[model samples]
Target: MVTSSILVLFLLGLTAAAVLAAASKVLHVKEDPRIAKVEGCFPGANCGGCGYPGCSAAAAAIVKGDAAPEICVAGGAEIAENIAAIMGTEVSFKEPKVAQNICTGGSRANLLFDYEGVEDCRAEALLYGGEKSCGIGCIGMGTCVKVCSFDAIRLNADGLPIVDMNACRSCGKCAEVCPTGAIRVSGMTMDLLHLNKVDDCLAPCMQKCPAQIDVRTYIQQMKQGDMRGALLTMKERNPLPLAVGRLCPAPCETICRRNIADEGVAIHTLHRFVADWEMNSGSRVRLDCNPPSGHRVAVIGGGPAGLSCAYFLRRIGHEPVIFEKRESLGGMMKGIIPEYRLPEKVVEWEIQTILDLGVDVRNGVEFGRDVTLESLEKEGFEAVFMATGAWKVPGLGIENDDAEGVVDAVTFLDEVGESIDALSGKRIVVVGDTNTAMDVARSAARLGADVSALISCIQRKMSANKNEVKRAAELGSDLKFLTEPVRVIAEDGVVKGVEYRELQYDDPKKATGTPKPVEGTETVLDADMVVIATNRLVDVDALKDQNGEPLFEMDKKTGGIKADKTTLQTSIPHVFAGGEAHTGRNIIIQAVADGRRAARAIHHYVTEGEIPEPKNPQLRVIPESILKNMQVVYNIPRIRVPEISVEERRSTFKEEVKGFVEYDEARKEGSRCLRCGLTCYDAEAGAEYAADPDVSRFDESGKE
Candidate 1:
């Protein structure tokens, strides 16, 4: 009986082994060879940071050429490059993204009551919203820190998670585990709605602004009807919103990513609207100044740059005394900008608002004449900032150019803008093709002069903004393109006309074409007073040292101050320079940016004894899941806010562009923004489902 049973068991075992062998051959699946090669290069954390199911799934996708190697968000630039290396292709990466903790209110969070409980976030989260006044904040439990496979997160002294970017695999685990949703990705796409601060994000619009203004935030605030909040965000970086709104040639609009499909957002006009709302709504930018630092700084030039420096410095608890040679505090805006374009009331209100922030403005105190750099230092001013603008004309060495009627455009505009009686019946010929020339011509026309502009460059080469040109044309100002003025024609100091020659471009396509004067084409153009609208020279005497040399080293080529481009620091260790005095873009927004930067550098130098390395704007990548149908949010066409009619513009300079944007209009216009920043995630929901996600839904987001 035992022998028979053993033989039967052995035969059954052999039959079973044969059946299993057949099943193995039938059930096997073949994977591509490249999948293994691709998997070999992965970071191997299997965090699903690349929006994949796992390392194996991500590897398979790469081999099938379904996604770029940069799909991994946690590994940043390195992982992207390595995956690209496996495919034998050059690395193409997207913006760098890292998880960031949003709430700094860890220790500051107020508690309803204190009670002992489990140390896990999920446990605390269920007990009366995690014991904090801010209901939607980090719960301070280490559930996320405990489960981190790469050990990238830790609690700071304040009980908030500190993300170590270098080690994080962006597996979305920590965000998934956080109970109160305090931690989030910084640059989530527009569709990825955030729990708080849904508007503020690092985007190309913010990066492109020289002011680095949080544009999307303010726009979002505007959409939500938070006018005060919108204005507050603008004031964080730029002190003057009303002035910039009316006068800035917003380069921010040019780089808007939405311009790829259609017209760019009217960002400057939106600024005007927001500022006007703040002004009309009786709201002031509210901020607490730092406690007095007991340091006095001297600032020269009271324009946007100087005022901006003073404003920021004062905000940080330092005292800044601004010196202006003019009787009033307006810089370029007051000095030259016409009342029609920038109302006198606007400049006065903007500058006065800054001055109200505990700044000292000493009018008629010249930099070099009344107050020397050495004297300022001797007077207990620890640092000096020079923003004396390019206010005078450099010698052009042209024949008969020294006549009394020959004026630099800046000074001419200043005088004409203040009192038009002298230029009221004068036949004015402004020389040059740059925006400066157009400004001179327009201001002269507003003053009742018959204005004409002489340009050495051809029609297409005119440097004035097209809007300015159109307005000037409508105002009956004549534009003489490709006509070069060779000399001022005058019998005495009083100007009568200008001698000119036609110019021919050697290459029409060249950006800076070689212009040759057409010989025998010289002719005398009639005029009453000739204004040379050229790049104004910095007033060297205005910034002279006691020895009569320039206070700062001068750039021989541009004849501007030699200051470090990034730091704005001059050769003198204690001095810094910016605005038109330094060689840089002279637009109003750019000057504002310089002022803010210099103020930051000066604050650090005074407080920390060293200038901090300039930090690039922190960026975050847009997930492909959100990008695939981004059009749903970004598909709205850009709205062109109606402007004051050409008839009204020509009739009076009473603020040419329309300032009003109704609530409905603002919503439509602002909606066109691409909001190129990251959105927050429902990581708690994500992680709960992470372990055993519904397969069909899991395949859609690729979130393991």
Candidate 2:
């Protein structure tokens, strides 16, 4: 019976084997031979840096043409070459990347509660946004260090991860494991392009400054005795550092961290000192630019905006030609600004430095009279930048404003430097209470004009620049408040006096009151000339085409070229406007910043045919409440900036603010900086996370 059973089982096994071999022959599929070759070329690390599951998946994708040979980041150039050889294709190279830690606040960061949870960062982050006060800061748990297969990252004494660039394969594993996104893998493009995001760390001074100069870095360079390095750093954002250093009102000083204790650092003076150092040493710092792109751009108006636009355009390999209506560059800066404030030699030097970068200049070339938009297009210019200044004088709301001896402040300042003798022993009455009016009154007094009075429709406190008003008064100009001009009394189309009336406000208690003209207060002030200090408008006629059609759309409110505030692009697709052309009478720093942004926009539009979206779309806003909470222990006093005496300032056109007397003095002032960042200050300023008895610790339930 056993022999019969064994015979049946053997026969069944033979039948089963026969069926399996037949099925295998019918259902078999073939695999690509190149997949194995590609897989063999991989580093076999399976780091997932290629966005695939493993080497086998990456190899299959490469074979199918879904992925490029250079997708294997760990394998690098050698492996990519080998894979390309096997796949019978050329390798497309990509920018190499390295890991960087975005958060610098480690031990200096504030805390919410003591963390006694699990050792892992991922676990600790589950309770109440981690222990650090900054939600986006590093968790200080070394999860990134553990996942780094190449041993490129290690935890420092401050519990922050430090990346070793040499061993880093750009695998992005550390960035992947990081819970708070503090660790990131960035490439060359990411480093060069600065776009603010919600998670970005920014200092208060950086956010306030229109140019966004790296205040902390430049001051640190100054402290380290790197005067040249500091100037170069300033030149990266602001092309006219020397002019800005002397003339900027310094809005950055208002929000400085040192203001919490004593006073803000002398940022403007430091900037001037570094810039003067470069000038005195007779060395100019011009960065290496890209090869010429063979594209020509016409920049109209040789002002701050035009110079800045040309500088950046040249830096990015595009040829820029500047067209100026006046004989010299620096629209208002060279024409209007008194030599006492910003010297002519400094302005000349600043403009010359920009010209040395291969930028072409055509003086006495008016935009409307000489060259139109169509003429520029016909001249093979790829793009046009309208960086015109606020030259058009607005109406004075008074009759006979067009008469002789009645000149606008812009025209007066422009002609004052060349023809100071024309105003000798003349009676001058300056209207309006703006800083420009004060400048006119002061300049007229200095040039031997018997200034009748400086009149304003607004209250005394409401006038522009109190110090300027006081200076004009000290220079022998009479001050007349709450007065409005009615008409320019002229004989034979020449001014003899200015008719005016005193204004009465409804709310007399408040200084910022609504003014009404008194019924019987008309009066006339005797004068030889009336200098109206009304605001300026853009020359729209200069922006017209040959057919009398507007080349660019006009902004109704601004009475200038309309442009997107962010992109600076006008209605015309190829033409762009910035600085006083769009925004009238802005600071020099703002004009420089606008020029840079407009240049970038133009470059992107010309080259890529589209505007480049910001890499980081949002800027993190640090609350003033939190900023004031910083425990500032240092009581260091602010260093005094050296300046010429008032007597000397009135006599000659020498620069009013003499720069730092010595390098050591400038260095000592630089060291007083708080070195602030986003939620971070100098570590010496007592850490905000110090233990407190009143504060709650980690509860048993692990709740906040």
lDDT of each: 0.73, 0.79
**CA shift at 75, candidate 1, in angstroms?**
37
For candidate 2, the 10 contiguous residues with the lowest summed lDDT are 695-704
Q: How many backbone clashes does candidate 1 have?
A: 8
The sequence of per-residue lDDT tens digits that candidate 1 reaches over residues 1-704 is 99999999999999999999999899987877878877777767787766788888988888888888877655556767877888877775243445676554565545678848888888877766678655666778878898787888999886878999887766778888877666665432111111123223345566567787878778878877888878877887788899999777787787665564445777888888888886776656675565567989999989899998898888767899999988998777885777677888788878878888899989998776788877888999988898888877665578888887887787777776354444577798888776778888877777678988878777666767777777777788888777878888888676888888888778756736658888999888778888887567777776666667766788887678898876789999789999888863377888888888788778777767887664442332222213222122123445566777766665576877766558777766776665444322111111222233221122223322
For model 1, what is the error of residue 350's alpha carbon versus the real structure, in angstroms, after optimal superposition? 0.9
Predicted structure 2: lDDT: 0.79
lDDT of 2 by residue, 505-557 (tens): 78767745567888898998887888888566777777777788887788888
Q: What lDDT score is found at residue 172 in candidate 2?
A: 92
For candidate 1, the per-residue lDDT at 24 reads: 88
Pairs in clash, predicted candidate 2: 197-618, 198-618
